[model samples]
Target: MSSTTPQASTTTDARRSFLSGFGKFTLSATAVALLAGRDRLALVGSAEAKTAGNDVTILNAALAAEQEAIAAYQVGATSGLLQKPVLDLAVQFQGHHKEHATALATTVKKLGGTPVAAKAKYTFPVEKLKTQADVLGFAAELERGAVSAYLGAIPILDDRELAKVAASILGDEAMHWAVLRQALGQPPVPSAFVS
Candidate 1:
């Protein structure tokens, strides 16, 4: 939504605070993206092993967020509020979230941690989603929160290479947000900073 939704705004605010202390842990990526460029992410150092437990916690949190995004897209796709083109875009965005979830789960397992499973339901504002624009607005709000979440986490990652991988994913999420805004006849990227 051009004017932020309550849920998305709250999540973004909370994540901003959580990500401020993100340096306490680190992520070590090994090919997190599959969009292009082979998505190669190598550990720059062995320091991450010492903080694997904390890393797992953070990764699981991000995984949970991505899963939520996937579920949100599913809700939008099946709401019968979107046209053919919009529905196709919603599906494609869901696929991206699935890829993100897969990569997060893979990394969590590599760190000897269990991935966080998706919940049976997420509290979406279904009553507010009455039109195609309403659905797009809901999705845009989620994407904006996602972009802010990833952006807030990227700078604080202890591993530079891991941050690089995260930046790539952040770029993808930013694109998703921008596209949703454009589809809603709003500015694609309203500001340089996600917040």
Candidate 2:
């Protein structure tokens, strides 16, 4: 024979095999990332995964909202618009937000889901926040939103332990709300409660 050449059919089969192996590897890597809670890109890569369930979606949403509060409080504490007392309290609220986020992530992991990442951007509802009073008012509103969201989640959570944790966090959020209101010159207790 003058010359011998590899069959085109063999080369095509090898290419297909390599592509199949790569597909499997990609799928495996994605699964591992989702399990490790590092695949928010992959988890949210599919809009279907993002809207899969009410409880899981709500937990993800709450994590985002709590993280927003934590970031806002941190900014307020360092912005010099707040007095030391307000700054200190803002730090405390930031701690609570972290705790809440940790608890939610733990629960989500235990339930065989990945915790959503905190959003890098958030919009605070405080067009009037210009002074210390305004900052405290903004904090109070954030806490109120957290408390209400937790209360709403309590009944929806299928896990009893998760519900209890939400209840505990709700109590802390309520306390933060009360403290913020007090610092903003409102009575510590509702006027109707004591009178």
Candidate 3:
């Protein structure tokens, strides 16, 4: 994805216009991904009934986190505090989140469980931000949480195929964190991610 350089002076009209367009673009992209996801699941055979419920529960938790990541990106994209490039990156990350959510939801359905719909309201680790830096910081944090969540689930999953899927998605989440860090002008990978 290409990044746009921030304009010399961003006006209220410019920010509003960009946000409106961005929202429409994101919603459309999410819809397409969901449709593709349903198609993909039709090809995979169902797992054993005994293990299916456990797999579905784990996947549902990950799906919830993916939904939260999507929400976080939406906030960053429409906040108007970020430059176009940064906002575009936020949208890109949101797209990945949607893909992950769809992939997991597909898995849950294949396993014979109802896919959980993410809550409309979620609690973000980062509170309201007073500056652009704060927003990017929150984005980075969300990506990291997603990365950890996927990694933790990968090892415990009984299904090897789903484990592979989680591995791939976790890798993408790691990349999202790096991109978010770069956007914030922080080290792409921190020396120590946590204390």
Candidate 4:
């Protein structure tokens, strides 16, 4: 009976260890699946479906904001107010907005939704671009708007990965705003916190 007791104890320990290892493996596999774009909630297909729908709506709104930013930059770049160097910078900022739009569109499609297209004509203050200062001021306002939109999106997005993406874009938009503000002879860091 003494030998049997030791054997039983060893068997129980081995079983516990096996369960621990198996649980770790399962968790790791789930993480990998999520990173690979497999929606875990979609596997069950009920509650998560609604969350996915909400995510699609938020992502489409973000895409539209990006499109608007791109249009604003295009107007500023072509207004004949910016010098060569400033125009180059405007184009660069526009490219960033385009990249954001592309990523948002891709994510929207991945969520089974169509992206909102840019309007045929956006009502930007094109007539207000009378000088370099005016152009920079307009671009700065648009960048600030982009920053606000992305900042708002970070909390609304259901997916952590999507929130991370929005945070990244927020950083980029904030930088654009700061630079444009400096160009407009305003304090770049207007406040300690952007809130």
The most accurate candidate by TM-score is: 4
- Across 72-123, the per-residue lDDT of candidate 2 in tens digits comes to 7755665467878667778667766776776666546644477987665555
How far is 113's C-alpha from truth in model 2 (Å)?
Answer: 1.0
Q: Which runs in model 1 stand beyond 4 Å of their true positions? A: 1-48
lDDT of 3 by residue, 26-64 (tens): 323433444444444444555555565677789899988
Candidate 2 C-alpha RMSD relative to the actual structure: 19.5
Give TM per candidate.
Answer: 0.75, 0.67, 0.72, 0.78
- Name the top lDDT candidate: 4
RMSD of each: 10.5, 19.5, 8.5, 22.8
Name the regions of candidate 4 deviating beyond 4 angstroms.
1-44
Estimate every model's Cα lDDT from 0 to 1.
Answer: 0.71, 0.63, 0.68, 0.72
Candidate 1 vs candidate 2: which has greater TM-score? 1
Name every residue pair that clashes in candidate 3. Answer: none
For candidate 1, the lDDT comes to 0.71
* Clash totals, every prediction: 0, 0, 0, 0
Q: Sort all candidates by TM-score, best to worst.
A: 4, 1, 3, 2
TM-score of 1: 0.75
Candidate 3 vs 4: which has more lDDT? 4
Q: What is the C-alpha lDDT profile of model 1 across 77-131, one tens digit per residue?
A: 6667789898889877877777777777877776667899877556777777889
Question: Candidate 2: what lDDT?
Answer: 0.63
